[model samples]
Target: MRNQLPSSLHNGMMNYLSDLEWKQVLDSLQQGLCCCGANKYADWLHTPWIHVDFLRENSHTVLRYMRVDGRALPPVLPSSCCNPFSPTPCLHDPLQQQRSLSVWRDTPQTAIDTVFDKGCLDLILQPMVELLTAIPIVNGCCIALQLISGILLRYIYTSARNSVLVGDPGGKAYGWIFGRGDCRFALGSSLLDIDKKRAAKQKPSGNSGQESKEIGPRRHE
Candidate 1:
């Protein structure tokens, strides 16, 4: 991500004059980060955005003209590239070769000191590196937690099985932890034994009722 930042920033900056959102983004980065350009202020020299005109001379038609002398002006930096501490006017005439203290200049290091000389990429890269570094550590922690949970569930299943087979009370203790689900799950056979006893008692009562009916009919005859 860091290696590709300069070119990406450059392309984004190339749209600075034509796209309002791009202009705002670059302005925010320049002002908030207190840095200039992709690598240095000199990067703006090759950008086509400098020559693009915002004003259309007439309402119905679009028109473009060179500076007063019919010669193209030199590359100009945006007002956002000005240092907050500089008292001088931030705007710089593109045709002039002299550097202004208020604005970011070409060969920024040798200029009168006011504007930020560092690249915006350098200011932002460290935090991005730290964030990327933390992602794998978080994923590893999640995997470790999942493994531990799997081991714990297997242990519970084993304990519950043992209590059912060996008739140990420990499974009831496990049931307390799971709101009695473990007891119902482990003691399912005891419930089935109860149902069988109830069926047998009902069968004997039905046989007695049939015997009484046969005795009554013989007495009547």
Candidate 2:
């Protein structure tokens, strides 16, 4: 993705004036990212937008383009690349833009003072790298959370069973505690097992009660 930005941006810049949507997208990207051309602001010189034929159609005619230090000046940069805080008047005046371009060629190190010199590729890749770095951390946190939850549920289920076995006051309360709507929803079949255990305990007592009633009726006879 980082290596492909130059060619993609070159194509986008070349087609910028031809398509209004592309023009807007390129403009917004440059302005929002605070970046210039593909690899550097100088890269814009190679795009079709800088050619005389294209410029002539847009009323930016140049009878004879200027040169500085025996080097032809790159045409004015897109307004998007111009630094709003810079004292340079390169963006609004064609001559000043050419002058700044010449200055840049003479001293590449000072380019950012006049226009955004950093490549869009580096700025775009920084955030992507940060997000990828965090993915493992986020995944580890989720796995730890699941482990803690499983341990907690196992502890609660065991404690509830022990309370019922020791005949805690209101032993049926153990059933009610796990049988509530939210608990059943979360524990599902675990609560069903508790219900089955309670039912089994009650059955023997019911049978004993029936046997005693029969014996009493026989003695009366």
Scored by TM-score, the top model is: 2
Tens-digit lDDT track of model 2 for 53-97: 444433343434523322233445777887777875434224445
Cα lDDT computed for each candidate against the true fold: 0.62, 0.65
On residues 48-165, what C-alpha lDDT tens digit does candidate 1 reach at each position?
A: 5654355333422122223554332244567678787876544433334334422434443434245556678878897888888999999999999998888788667655664565
Among all windows of ten consecutive residues in candidate 2, which has the lowest summed lDDT?
Answer: 64-73
Which residue pairs collide, candidate 1? none
What RMSD does each model have against the real structure?
15.6, 12.5
TM-score of 1: 0.54
Candidate 2: deviation at residue 111, Å?
A: 6.2
Alpha-carbon shift of residue 169 in model 1 (angstroms): 4.3
Best by lDDT: 2
TM-score of each: 0.54, 0.58
Find the number of clashing residue pairs for candidate 2. Answer: 0
